[model samples]
Target: MTDSADSRASLGDGIRFAFGTLTVLPVRVARWDRAAARAGMLWAPLAGLVVGLFAAAVGGALALLDAGPLLAAVASAAVPAALTRGLHLDGLADTADGLGSGKPADDALRIMKQSDIGPFGVITVLFVLLAQIAALYELYGESWAQGALAAALSAVTARLALTLASRTGVPAARPGGLGAAVAQTVGMRTALTVAALVVAACAAAGTLFGASPVPSAAGAAHCALAAVAALAAAELLLRHCARRFGGVTGDVFGAVAETAATATLIALAVR
Candidate 1:
């Protein structure tokens, strides 16, 4: 009983840590060790779930208020940035600059660590953000419920990438920091379990929402496909990072999440 209680408490701490690290949430994490970091990653998708819900809510409210889809989409896009304080965006920028430079591993890593954004970073962020906003606008224009479901699933699947990236056999690019701390901490079984659960939850939510008078089999399929696509994209990015950067880094993880989210949203926008 005592051991079970301790495990429960630690799990709670891990959930708190996941939220605290990933978002601007007020949760305070009391522990900071490899064990805690690994535990926290298992719950990383929960943070995405929270962000997605908020984004969906924002889009829904604007739609109900008769706002234009473009405005609604922009505001919805801003939701994740606000919640995460643009942490993922920063990572996206850094990773772009690093990889685009085509420098050696050490130099690339150094470029990623710079405080200011470079030309490559600026271009990458601009294009990616615009793509997300445009895709979301199209989705919102179709149906508010569809838009919300897409947003939620995209966010969830995006963060799910982190779990895959942290799975055993993946290595850290450097000796210390977020990547090293959580790298290879997630077992293959754990990653697969989380991925399956996320995909299932998204499918269920999509089906439930699809039954709402309109009856959209496409919507349900889109949600499931988006989740799978996001995971596949993340895997490709992980392999690229391993080859280009020597291994995954904090920036690489962030880039993976953002890229996956964007890709999912784009897939949903497709007719």
Candidate 2:
């Protein structure tokens, strides 16, 4: 195909991939094959923007229903899961189950791929989601904007963590999967660019919205904590996974992103 034709085809594929992730579609386009991997990676933050905004809107609407913080927080979570159909949540469970096995790399990978959920996986998913809901509930007190910003920060930072993990030596567990695709598509340059963008965004956020953020200190803290916690939690999870399984699967990446976001929000609540 001509270059122009290839560009158009690539664009179509990327749109499909993003749409598939955000909706209940079976479309699965690998990240690398896109003609604009670098630009496409930007989709990560964009997903956060969409998901975060939807979550905040849900909470706001629920507030009008006289829902408590818990209910509002629960509402906040529904949008993300619906958008991605719990894809990352599944990854989190699988990774937790696989790593909890304490078996050899091959064995762990095998267990992770199983359709049946293990005890560890079940508990991990529950606690993580609970933490996120609880923290978001705390942020739901008065400032929808703060809650929305926190959610947005969580989503974007979680994706940024994914971008960060791409630079590490975590090879794909399989030959053909999202892990392999992202690893191949996201190079040093792409990762670095994302990093710079994230930093800039955070700086701008803190300067612009730090003082009036919801729950006052507590709410702002959660938002900031969620962002940092997302990165830290993902790093720890990836390290543990690497040590246990020798490599990361696409599921692990999603799992890590979800887990990190949950942990970040939870930490903010408790702090």
Candidate 3:
């Protein structure tokens, strides 16, 4: 095969890996090697973009039918959960339980690995879901466009967090599992490039879609702010988890993704 064909095949494998692992999308992952993982992490936001668009469509449809912002918000918030089979949420719950346990790192990790949800997990999941729903409700109340933007922005930001988390210098907490497979697979430069692109696209989206056909600086700024805030919030969580767990885990990735998404939603919710 020519170099170009090899590149294309590699790209296809990456997309398959990303969607297969990050979503319930019916793509078959052709490779599970580091090369594929590297590509997949870089492509993570693209998978998120699809998920976000679907989420926005669902919520917008509900709102157009006059289901009201509350129902629309619920449906929008539920879409990501449904698409990913609630893996991220489950991670969020497990991470919360582990962190809130106030136990040693090994013990906490053990707690996170457990199947049952603990009190801390339950409470954390409840509040996080409430916050997401509440923020979506506020945005939907303002306009379906706003709600949809928030939905899409949050999803993209969530996956972007995963990309950053997988960058070089970050280690896996365990020797095996999804985290180990992808951890440190992405180069710092590659991760930053993907992140910069995502932010620019989001800002451009806001500017184009804002109040009118004419570009709106305010809309662009609003989106840029949300994206930055989401990254910052996710970064903080990633740092803490690294310190707490000694490195990243599948659960930590989930926790940071949810954190970024929630932060993005909250940032957009503010008037």
Alpha-carbon deviation at 27 in model 2, angstroms:
7.9
lDDT of each: 0.85, 0.67, 0.91
**True-structure lDDT of candidate 1:** 0.85
Give the 10-residue window scoring lowest on summed lDDT in candidate 1. Answer: 1-10
Number of the candidate with higher lDDT, 2 or 3: 3
Q: Evaluate residue 268 in candidate 3 and report its C-alpha lDDT on the 0 to 100 scale.
A: 88
How many residue pairs of model 1 clash at the backbone? 0
Number of colliding residue pairs in model 3: 0
Model 1 TM-score (2 dp): 0.94
Please write out the lDDT profile of model 3 over residues 1-271, one tens digit for every residue: 1222223337888899999999999999999878788888889999999999999999988888989999999999999999999999999999999999999999999999999999999999999999999999999998888898889989999999999999889899888989999898887877898899999988987885467878998899889889989999999999999999999999999999999999999998886
Using lDDT, rank the candidates from best to worst.
Answer: 3, 1, 2
Model 2 steric clash pairs: 92-255
Per residue, candidate 1 scores C-alpha lDDT tens digits across 48-89 of 999999999998789778898888788888999999889989
Q: For every model shown, what is its TM-score relative to the native structure?
A: 0.94, 0.81, 0.96
lDDT of 2 at 123: 98
- For all the candidates, what are their Cα RMSDs to the real structure? 3.1, 4.5, 3.0
Candidate 3, residue 60: Cα displacement in angstroms equals 0.5
Question: Backbone clashes per model, in order?
Answer: 0, 1, 0
lDDT of 2 by residue, 33-121 (tens): 53443334445666566666777678767766677667877888777888788888888888888888988888888888898889999
Best by lDDT: 3
